[model samples]
Target: MKKLFIILILTGLIYVTYLNKEIFYKYPEAVRYTLKNSNELQRAEFEKVLKYFNKEEDNLKLKCAQVLISNIPLYSYKKEPETFNQVVDSIHALKNKLIIYSDSLKYNKRMLKKVQDLFVDKMNFLCKTNDFFDKEEVRDIDTLSSSFLIENINLAFEAHYKLPKKYRTNFNDFCNYVLPYRNDREPLEFQKRRELYEKYSWVYDSIKIKPLEDIVIQIYDDLKINIDFKKLSNLNLSPTPSQIEKLQYGLCRDVTNYFVLLFRSLGFAAGTDYITTYGNRHSPIGHNWFFIMYDDTFLPIQARSKSLIFSDIEKIFKLTNMPKVYRNVFNKINFKNSSINIDTDVTNMYRPTSTVQIENIFQTSNKEDFKLCVFNKKSNWFEVDKNFKLNNNKVTFNNVGRGIAYAVTNSFLEPINYPFYLDYKGNLMFLKNKNLKEDIPFNITRKYPPIDLPNKWKIDRIKALNNCKLQGSNYLDENSFKDIYTIKNFCSTQKSQFLFKKEEKYRYYRLIAEEVTSYTSYIAEFALINTDLEPIKNVKIDFYGTKESKLKQKSKITDNDPLTFGRFLNMKITFEVENNQNVSGFEIQARNDDNHINIGEEYELKVFDKAWKRVRKEKAKDTVLNYKSLAKDGLYILHNLTKGKEETVFTFDENGNQFWFGVSDVNDLGVGAPMSMGFK
Candidate 1:
């Protein structure tokens, strides 16, 4: 009996080795690494997948299995809690119940709101539960099933071969971009690749006959129309593809993952490109977008319909000044100077980039590496490029995004020097304030970049006020109005100012629209100009012929808030000044984001040395702020201390115009305002 048992154990060992023969024979080192990192069950699962692929004698499928097995050790994933699906199911049930009750007039908006609040509360509680939180992380090597790998590989191969000749990519690109089963930290599920492929088959069929760019547009449009990009209340959940499909909503990252997976399901070589943090200090949140490899180019697609822009070159130029952009890949990239291996740096793919070498003045005894960091919110720095050992006390960083401020720091986060930025020509401009006693007068026109214009839907807003008239009148009657100035050309600016030789002492001024231009011919701020072409002081305005209340309406026209608007819908709007004051000209402003200096808001100015130091604080008494006695050649930030949050770091020219970092050839007044023209 002992001899028989020994023979049987030997036979089972031989069978197990035979099943895992391809991985062990072809990639012995990878097999050893995977087995060393995997537990007993995971080891068995890996063997099962290799055995299944080897038995079928499918060499391509076996190669795919080997790729996944070799790379599985580098990734980790989270398992969804049991209560997660239960909560989602319960929410759906409640929604159905509410809908049925509402059919009989049994539930009102308040009742629905109460239900939503209860659901949010429950999900929030689930997010904080310690038991589920602590057990969330699990290595993919330890949990991925053999069946899941087999189905994912089989479906990926099937969809890949179905692509047209022009769209078909190489095997290496296919393996990295199209064959990966997971793009995010979401859980892996069996048959997900097959399920998604079947669901998106129709999309592939419809666009297969078209060009590569059209294919991307079709996919983007489908996602934009069907899926809603929303942040779920369950903050802890890294939603899987199945969950995203059901919810039809997710954050930018989640939507990006879904978009890539949908393209990969149809055998397109697709992946995600992301910015870990924006380069501008005011833009705190990072962004992610989908991209597909076509003709050896990464074609970018926005996450949602919020922008509706899909051109690759345009998106790249528009999203310039990003600190760093990284592309997701399956195999770990062994960067020469850094330990980070998951994502590859693609910053140069977006814009003109440069290599910078800096002297490490803050070197310490430890001889730790230095990093290039971008400025974020208040006093925080995000590492953009890291792991540069000081070569003779000098470190070189590669592919640096120009037009953005960067601070070099040691491993201890100690700065090597004061903050500095690169110009468009790759010239370093240090953020050092010349501590002079001389007073330098400059105007502050905007708090942020003027790139905030209308999207595709309202693209004609700037040209809408082409024929509108700026008139002056001594009487309140409409017949008494005289045309002070007529806008003969298309309005090409956010704030258009005109001055004419006029000696008339008119008590009233009016902006009248004759032709219907757009959905609404709206003006954000109507400024009555004095003889010197400055905004008239203490001006009062009133509207006539419109039933809309005039109680707070005058402020809408004169408050200097670009977001608030006063429309002239076949109506008369008048700006009344003091009897002693005569209107010489007028300033017309189109609808815009409220980033300009407000009349009543207080502003704080600061300059950066080792840290931000207060320069001055003043209340805005006019549409423009005339700052006095500021240091020369200093990087400054203007903060609206009263209410607003958006602020950009800037420097001024000899002409007292603001120059924003990262934005090229742009000033405080004209960051290419027409919305028709791209960024200047």
Candidate 2:
């Protein structure tokens, strides 16, 4: 009787195990590893997805599921309204209002300001309501539903198989590039990926018969019209496809993310490439763009531009200077130097690169490894490239971009030595101070490089100054003016001088605009100078212009503020000097970034020996700052003590021109001519 009872109990235990077979099923090693890290509920949800795929007999999609499941644990999204349905509706309402205002020429500045204020208020309200927008990272493994995962896998495979044979990528490539449900912090809502596919798939349909490049170009062109790229906050928020479609305002990274998702939605393999910092310290902010795969090769496209040919992209890179560039992939892989698991170095493929070797002064043994870093902020260094091993008392970093300042550091980012920069020819130039006792004369003009806009410098503002006349008159009448000087060429400098001897004593002087284009013109600051080349103080000035230009206060031309400009089609300014005998020349300042040194603003100068040491602190009495002699071959930085944060390190050339070390070393940045420093 006891043996029979034991047999019955064993049978009951076997039945219970068989009943829960699907729940305890095994997955691939990588997928199982992620599952092990997940909670019981998360594991059950993933198991349900696997069982559904297995029962359907969809082996291809089942493999894609494994790829996504293995990497999804690391991905998360912000629990914000950027992906919600209500946000899209709100954006559309605001966009409609914008369209109405933009369509009307009768709208005045007041009306425009009203619209802008409304937009700002709406955005602020939306941002403030969501504390989780930047505060929380909601993991997909914890929140993702089984149905969402299954559908994403199905749609990705469907799109991949739909592509033409020539444009189609291998399974591995598709899985790594196009199959991921989410990249970065994009939203992980149910049916979001499929919704994106359904919406943008039309862009591919009309151009399907065309070559892959043409179709890709058309898609980009259409998207650009629909999505408005803006210089929004540099918060690195990855806008969801829905947000991009509705709001149409995003930064470079946000736009790049949108482009990648749009391309992947239509069955094309696409990804993002970015730099955390530029080679030049003047513009420390980084940039990102999208790339598409064609014939086993990926081609990059600019984020805010129209579709560019492959050659155009290459040419842009040849002119661009970057310390490091990284590509984002779906696979759970990481470089030794980077903590990001999805990044791969692609700097060499974009620009001229070199292998860097430096003495391993900090290394205690051959087993020691180090990080190469770039200057980021005031005394801050950011790690880049790959982690290098120490060998033979030397550390080597490969595929380093040229024309950038670099330093060596441990994992904690503690610097081992003073920073050094790479020249355009891929040579290292050290920054150690050779003469600490001696000071150097420093003349600073701009704290930051002027913002580069296409056709802005040479074409719009400068070209408007062509044939502009400077005149002197003993009388206030315009007819009494005699031409002192006529600008024959574009004045490239923001602050330019037109000097001539005042042969005749003139009480009145006037600067007149000539050959102006319909393109809006502006004059920031204007001044009359004495024979000694000093500005005549307390001069009474008045402005006259065409009727259209009269709407604006033309007095802004002499406002003494570079940012406050008088916009005009045609205008003239007349000033009466108390004495005409001293009049010699006049000065003109164009509309600029206000980066030039301002009189009365305090400045601090520092040079790096072992660390940054203050050399002098004083207020600027002139447009330029003249200091004592500087230490030879030292790294120097100038800071605006009063305001602003865009200062950078620089050295002086033979002519005392500010040679921005990293900026000018790049070939086509058009900043300043490189100096022939006596370094090989």
| Top candidate, metric TM-score | 2
Clashing pairs in 2: 439-628, 439-629, 439-630, 440-628, 440-629, 440-630, 441-628
The models' CA-based lDDT, in order, is 0.70, 0.67
State the local distance difference test value for candidate 2: 0.67
Against the true structure, what is each candidate's TM-score?
0.74, 0.79
Q: Write the per-residue lDDT of candidate 2 for residues 1-680, one digit (tens) a residue.
A: 99999999999899888876544445666676667888999888887787777855687777777777777777787655343346456655766676676766554434443443454456556565554255456887788778888877888878877777666788877877787776556665566667778876765555466666676676666554222323246233445676666555567767777777777877788888888877556545677888888686877887764444654566567556577899887877321122345477889888778888888565544444477887766546667754575667777788898767788766666656557777768778787767533344656676654333111342356457667778888887657888888877654435677787444457887777773534445678778777677777878877665443432554566666667777656657677888555677788876666667777899888876656789889898887777556655677778888887677676665545566664444444444333222110
Number of the predicted model whose lDDT against the real structure is largest? 1
Off by over 4 Å in 1: 1-27, 55-57, 76-135, 203-208, 225-237, 306-312, 315-319, 333-340, 362-366, 387-389, 435-440, 452-514, 520-593, 620-629, 664-680
TM-score of 2: 0.79
Q: Candidate 1: which pairs clash?
A: 403-662
For model 2 the local lDDT of residue 569 reads 60
Q: lDDT, candidate 2, residue 353?
A: 80
Q: Taking the tens digit of each residue's C-alpha lDDT, what string does model 1 give over 375-488? A: 765555677779465577777888887767888877766678767887657888776687443455787787786563223323255556667777777788768998877776
